[model samples]
Target: MTSEFAVELRDVVKRFVTPEGNEIAAVDHVTMQIKNGEFFSMLGSSGCGKTTSLRMIAGFEWTTEGEVYIEGNPMGHTPPFQRKVNTVFQSYALFQHMTVFQNIAFGLEMEGAKEDEIKQRVGRALEMVQLTGMERRKPKQLSGGQQQRVAVARALVKTPDVLLLDEPLGALDLKLRKEMQLELKALQQQLGITFIYVTHDQEEALTMSDRIAVMSNGRVQQIGTPVEIYERPSNKFVADFIGESNFLDGQIKSLSKDEAQVFIPALNTELRGIPISQGLVKGEDVVVSIRPEKIRITEKNAKNDNFFKAKVTNTVYIGADTHVYTESQGVKIKVLEQNHISRLDTSSFYTVGQEVGLVLMPENTLVLKKV
Candidate 1:
């Protein structure tokens, strides 16, 4: 019988022995369920177990504990070729000496498929990636993007149930990488296949993934949609990693069903915020997180709840937005404001040492556990 999940890792762990003969858990008890036809991403920096988890799913490495299930079946000792999945790596892994057609057809040829069937499948796969006419060219003749597409086509020609991509766009320039991110998302949607992507770039994961698993220190920190992960991080690590957040060390002064009052010692005020982390209690130490863009700054002297008097310390303009650095009661905070209005004069911008009011809305403020 078919399952709703395309892949599942049940408390998976992968341990490696260091050259000094010390054992370390590269993947520490990671558990996740990837739905069929979903674009799931494992995002983290290097040595965070994101790549090791992907390799485990791809059969390059086996779990030291727990099990890996693919399509409701346990994949114990299943070889890469036997599993109904394919992977495209950062290097593209295209054969240098072969034409695009030959490289794409190599997998099918190994499966001992008839020549006509191989050609038909290869043509369809190439068309899927918009590389139909480039089959006769060598890998060297194609541009970086084109070669990447050829690599994708080779993987797609096999028609696996799931596709694994390990930083496939890492080699491309920024502009091309941005372009390919959209293309890959569109292709995944069009094909309606499960895609398990691994990348360290936060923006890339946010742009392309339907859901993301944020990993760090051999453990999965949080898994949710891009908006959820960015807007409501589970802990300090997630808040600081996924995006820029101004964190205030605080203690819970009072608690309600959905909101909490946090007393920040640095600011000497109690700020109200929605408590997102589980098991929060009254008088518990917590961290108040607010995104740089969420804090509103105005020149008007508005005294209200959660409002602070801040002085501008620095200002930076980067075409689309201006980053304003400020200090309130000795606490450093950064604010990002968009250039919504076109202006030629610098008079409207905040000046250094200018006093301003910062409004931190309770809805936009997040209270996380102090991990």
Candidate 2:
């Protein structure tokens, strides 16, 4: 009912009966507001209901409960074609027999637009997707990325209020996928249209979305900006899912508004000044989430309160960064240290079983509820 949001889902639910005759909620009680001209994403792994939620918005599947709204109007069981939305699927579903121009113009043709209007719209669509000169080529003649562009152009030629993308970059290889992620973000900003993107890849979501809704078991776990989601995760699942984290089981020893202390039995030490999640009480079990890049590997004791002496169990020297695996008090931890110098001798590299000290900065260490 709110005009501020381009798309809104209010407590939407989608259930399906399995082959064993058991009903399950594929999308459970989902509610979100996608702003106009915003790039919002639903991110999760397989079976997390991200694609299911997108389908509900695209009208491929009806919600079992709650409501779906679009552009200040309630969309109750409206057919996909009737709604002001278009979808780009993972398969790049372009008509193989149709040339790029025809593929882009098909939607306008179906809407009964005049020949001149259709040609003008199709030309603009191709230009928007950066396939201006590929008009005469068929889908089969295009590369994977180019074919994907055709799919996007087809959807855009409809001039829908919102575009739903269901893993549109899933079929591309790593390099092309990364390139398209940035390209799509730029395109969304240029067009200023609501984009409801669904993907299981965490990196892609973080790189593209203005805000991300992380889901699991058909329920949304957290929704926030990429920085907020990564740095101040709402729970343990979020910390572990968005990026690499070194989780240490601990219990809260003291709590305060500005600081807290957690006792880790494995390290035989308590970490203090670590930021605590909301409602975290004293004496409650928690996990300390430290990113691999946040931990500093030092040869000396650093004389810091958060420093711990450990032995390196493994060392992997990748060109950009070196992954140092160490064990402190039977707790395995990983440190991602950036390579700043060129050392030709292997002696300069950290060796296995080398004694080292690991430092956990107070700000980077997060105390999260053990979910």
Candidate 3:
């Protein structure tokens, strides 16, 4: 572990003995480094070891194998408060009887800090979260978003080297959660402190993280920026989990440096220039994943190598875009297109059972491993 990393998990594993006397690894062989002052996230669904990993880092759960290092120092027996880290949980666990100021200053008071210093630190932390002048109110007087801010301020007043957040925004509604994503990202950058966030929501992870570590089954599938994860997934799990993708089974006919020709059985034709995954070979069975938004649905046929004509089965006109569903060769294809044209005219939008052309360009197509 290097000093540049704020936290390092070297093959950390957490195992629990099930009631059936079976041992299961909740966090298995996970190894990664969180860069200093970076907003990193562990994203996965429930029981995928995301929260267990955070607990290990926060000293709630001890590592069963490997080591956890903070700032190049091993955290073998160090306790939570002594390890220079604080955690903001999903519940926003505040004292109901205490005022906002008291909750925020409680940690400092626990450390035996002078009253004057605790007041100054708590005031600054409140200012950082933009919740100043509401010090006298109790947790019951605040909204969900305000209570979340109080939780953040309470942890931040400690000035820990790293802040561990376990789905802090999971309690908020959709709109407020989205708003806090941007706000938290901005605050992290302004403070230049490491933040380790955990979330199961894909959109929230993409919205806030500087880089994401996508985990599943207690293992990391891939780690990259939001664009890389969405654009080029490493395997089937990643492709299916990140976003909506139309997967078509195929076999590689030929492969080149940047593209591959795949033979899709449903279409009974070969698609050329489909981007291939690393180490893909010819004649190997693969899956061609193309996002619905990438396909263009129009009346005119594009006489290119990667075009298909199908009959539209359904059309749904949402506010910003329309989801057009078409079927051809026993394969249902979904196309998402922007409603840049007028929708008042029902004739303009493709009606059900109407013939439409779908263009799957090479730039937007991704050929993935079967896995």
TM-score against native, each model: 0.97, 0.96, 0.96
Q: Cα-based RMSD of the predictions, in order? A: 1.3, 1.6, 1.7
Model 1 — TM-score against the truth?
0.97
Kindly give the number of clashing pairs for every candidate: 0, 0, 0
Candidate 2 lDDT for residue 51? 92
Please give the distance, in angstroms, between residue 271's alpha carbon in candidate 3 and its true position after superposition.
Answer: 1.1
TM-score: which is higher, 1 or 2? 1
lDDT by residue for model 2 (197-279), tens: 99989989999999999999899999999999998888889898999899999999998897898999888987988876678
- The candidate scoring highest on lDDT is 1
The residue pairs in collision within model 1 are none
1-371: candidate 3 lDDT, tens digit per residue: 24999999999999999999999999999999999999999999999899999999999889999899999999997888678899998999999999999999999998999999999999999999999999999999999999999999999999889999999999999998988999999999998989999999999999889889999999988989899999988887888899888999999999889789999998987888877668899899999999999987655566766888899899898989999889988999888988888898888788788887788888888888887
Runs in model 1 deviating more than 4 A are 273-276
Give RMSD (Å) of candidate 3 vs. truth.
Answer: 1.7
- Each candidate's lDDT (Cα)? 0.92, 0.91, 0.91
Which regions of candidate 3 are displaced past 4 Å? none
